[model samples]
Target: MRVPHIYQASSIALNTPVSLNDDAAGHIGRVLRMKVGEHVSIFNGEGGEYFSEIIEVTKKSVVVMPLRFDEHNVESELNIHLGQCVSRGDKMDFTIQKSVELGINEITPIFSQRCGVKLSGDRLEKKHQQWQKIAISAAEQSGRNYVPVVHPPVDLKQWLEQHTDEIKLTLHPRAEHSIKTITVPSAGVRFLVGPEGGFTDEEMAQTKQQEFVDIRLGPRVLRTETAALTVLSALQLQFGDLAN
Candidate 1:
């Protein structure tokens, strides 16, 4: 049977007892119904994972003893920086979750000209926290040692101003080339996708000024969420560990 892998923020050492936080404890006890003495893996989202066994089960906490540490190397060699235009409702959440599983190194929610959701201040903070949690869950489920970060939303123009990547491309329905046509970068790659209504003319101009090459998946025009997921998967298959 596959043991559960949980993400914890604290550092852990071998044979040392560690307590799960309220949320993680509830997940192990109430949700998964993991009892005392059950084996589980705990990771700090840094590098390796700990081989742990549940020692004490309580209402508010679950204590575990880490037995050993194993180095992990499941991340893709291709470092993809996803500039995703925030979509409405759970679409954005779905996109971030799947992207993490597909090996995206960084995700930045871009507020483009046609984005439906507008967030600021406290609302933005809440959304950022929620998205980060989703990415963490995906990393655990996908056997990733490192969790990809979900950056706070920024304007498309602002993102372009400071952007630097080995290869930069923006999705365009009318573009003449697919990912296969572009030369692979030496280190990392960057991708940009638009919202439901697509990027406005002015925003496209800005992307062009930043040297974001226009690329197409095919003749079909994909939705904001679909476009991001599809492009990321393609990159993984071509240059990431998925090719093996």
Candidate 2:
């Protein structure tokens, strides 16, 4: 059987017993029904993983002793930060999950003029936490030791104004440039995926002003969720780990 990979919020050290947090504990003890002496892999999002064996399991916690450490790195060489305009319902959740699996390093939920979601205050904070959890889960499932970050939601303008040396891109149907035509970036990549209704003309103007090059993916327009995944896969194939 494949050793279960669990993410713990606590620091881990070799030969020391580590108690998993409640969420992970529940997964190993209650959900997986794992017994003592069973092996599990644990990562704290600090890079690499600990090969541990369960020493204790209780209703409330699971304690494991680290036997060895692997400096495994599955992150893409092409660093990508995705600025995705919030889509409604489970669309947003699905995008966040699949984006992490596609090797996106950072994701920021963006509030554009056409974005229909209106979360704020505690509700917004809760959603942000949920999205982060999705990212972590994706990392574990995809065998990625380093978890990607799901940053707090920000306004489109706020995200656009942040200075970045990376290549900036935004989708535009009428644009002359395609992803194939843009010069390969030496550093990272920052791209925007607009909402289901697409970005307003004013928002498009702002992106251009911020030096976001408009690029066309293909002839047919894709849905908001499809667009995000397509961009990630295309970029990965062109410049990231999938290039191999």
Candidate 3:
């Protein structure tokens, strides 16, 4: 069986015992039914993993002794920050999950002109926190040492103004530019994906004025969530850390 890799927020050090919080404890001790002395890998999402073994497993907590520390760097050479337009219901959640698994470095939920989701105040905070959890879970599952950050929702224009990445692009179905034809950026990319209804003409024009390259995924129109992951995969395969 594959040893479980769990995400713990606590700091891990060599030859130290770390106590897991209740949620991780429940999953490891009850769901997985792992007993004391079983080996498991734990990471704090701080660029390394602690190879540990369960020393004590209880209903409330699981204590593990770190046997070794390994610096497993799984980050992509390409730093990608996805400005994903906010969508309704589970679609937005699914987008954040898949994006993290596909190796996005950071994400911002963009509330664009065509985005129909209206979130504010506490409700918006809750949604952002939930998306953050999704990113953490994906990092743990995908064997990533560092967790990608999911920033709170912001207006597309505001995010555009704050875009400081070396390579900036936006997805538009009717764009003349194809990603396959562009040169690979040496530093990082800040890409945008539109919502269900896509971006408005004014938004497109503004992005173009900002010098954001408009790129097309293909002829077939993909869903709002599908476009982000597809572009991430393509970038990773072409210029990032996917050597295989």
Q: Model 3: per-residue lDDT, tens digit, 73-176?
A: 88888888999999998998898888888899999998988899999999999989999988988888888888898987889889888848468899988889
Clashes of each: 0, 0, 0
List model 1 lDDT by residue over 1-244, tens digit each.
Answer: 8988899889889999999877689899989999988999999888999989999998888999999899977888888899999999999999999999889999999998789999999999999999999998999899888999898889888888864756889999999888889887776888899999998899888888899899999989899888988998888888777878
Score every model by TM-score: 0.97, 0.98, 0.95
**Could you report the Cα RMSD, in angstroms, for every candidate shown?**
1.1, 0.9, 1.4
Candidate 2's residue-wise lDDT over 74-187, tens digit each?
Answer: 888999999999999999999999999999999999998888999999999999999999998898889898888999999999999999989999987778899998775777
Q: Which of the numbered candidates is closest to the native, going by highest TM-score? A: 2
lDDT agreement with native, every candidate: 0.89, 0.93, 0.88
With a 3 Å backbone cut-off (N, CA, C), the pairs that clash in candidate 3 are none
Evaluation by lDDT, superior candidate among 1 and 3: 1
Tell me model 1's lDDT, rounded to 2 decimals: 0.89
- Candidate 3 lDDT for residue 155: 90
Cα misplacement distance, residue 227 of candidate 2 (Å): 0.4
Cα displacement (angstroms), candidate 1, residue 224, comes to 1.1
